[model samples]
Target chain A: MKSSVRNQFEGTIKAIVRGEAVSEIDVETAAGIMSSIITTRSMEEMGLKVGDKVTAAVKATAVFVEKA
Target chain B: MKSSVRNQFEGTIKAIVRGEAVSEIDVETAAGIMSSIITTRSMEEMGLKVGDKVTAAVKATAVFVEKA
Candidate 1:
């Protein structure tokens, strides 16, 4: 599928922290560990698990940056 | 302030695409252009604009990854 997101990193799942509503997924990439917060439903839908290979697609808008 | 998010990249603002409520921000990092979608209020509060230096903090749950 076509995406407007510019950063796409191929990575392996390192960990998953499941919450009541949201789930935090850690993807180990060459750059580093990329983290993501998604709904538990989406997590289940994706069937994400540790050691799985996945692509982390980040849209420009979802990134929040603060000055250093 | 401390954060649970793991991925933090120092970058410069490249562009900002504003919407009615959410805004898309493009940050130029060494890895590439990191993009984020945030509320307009947050954008205004940060005073985010092109050329500004900021750190992109991404939580594991906020990142969505698909198997490739």
Candidate 2:
């Protein structure tokens, strides 16, 4: 689906940490490792596994850039 | 503070949409505009305004990467 949210990075799954409700996923991008949290159900629905190619999409609102 | 969360982007604030509880923030990076949703209180605490430089940090658990 089309979205206003930007910052999409194509990467490979580096790791997955399953929790009770949320699952932590790490994507290795050229820039660095992009981390994400999603519901375990979504993780199961996606059938995500290590070495899989995925795109990390972040909404501008969810991004917090620190001043430097 | 140190964090395990990765995918930090250095960028400038593009826009901010203040809502009753949550606020939408947009950061312009070389890659694109990274959108983020933060609490209005956090926004105020950060004293975030347009044209400010900030780093967008995303926890691996909070990020969702879709397989393609």
Candidate 3:
């Protein structure tokens, strides 16, 4: 699908930590391993598995930066 | 603020695009320039300016990955 998210981490699925409601998809990207949380239903529907190629996209509006 | 967001990109502010209600903050990180859209009030309260150090944090749930 097309995405407007500027922060796109293209990588392979490192792991999938499934919870009752949500699941964490750990992707191995050049930036390092990043985690994405999605619903278990979506996870199953998407058929995402370890070693699968994916692009982790974060919307600009959802991005929050703190003073460091 | 103490955040539970795992995704953090530490960088210096490259620019701030101000709008009526929200503003876009662009930070230069190792990954490249990342943009964060935040409310103008938060931007003003944080006193973020160009060259200021900040860490862009994205919540795990806010992250969405697509099959590639």
- Top model number, TM-score: 3
lDDT of 1 by residue, A21-47 (tens): 988888887667788888889889888
lDDT of 2 by residue, B1-68 (tens): 88765778777898999998998888776556678888899889889999998887775545677877
Q: Which window of ten consecutive residues has the lowest lDDT sum in model 3 chain A?
A: A1-10
TM-score of chain A of each: 0.86, 0.89, 0.85
Question: Would you list the C-alpha lDDT of every candidate in the order shown?
Answer: 0.80, 0.79, 0.86
DockQ of each candidate, alpha-carbon based: 0.51, 0.51, 0.71
User: What TM-score does structure 3 among the candidates reach?
Assistant: 0.84
Residue A27 in candidate 2, Cα distance off native in Å: 0.8
Error of 1 at A65 (Å): 2.3
**Highest lDDT model number:** 3
Lowest lDDT sum, 10 consecutive residues, model 2 chain A, at A59-68
Listed in order, each prediction's TM-score against the native is 0.64, 0.66, 0.84
lDDT of 3 by residue, A1-68 (tens): 56567888688999999999999999887666678999999899999999999988888989887885
Candidate chain B TM-scores, in order: 0.84, 0.86, 0.86
Of models 2 and 3, which has the larger DockQ?
A: 3
Q: Which regions in candidate 2 have their CA more than 4 angstroms from the true location?
A: B11-33, B36-54
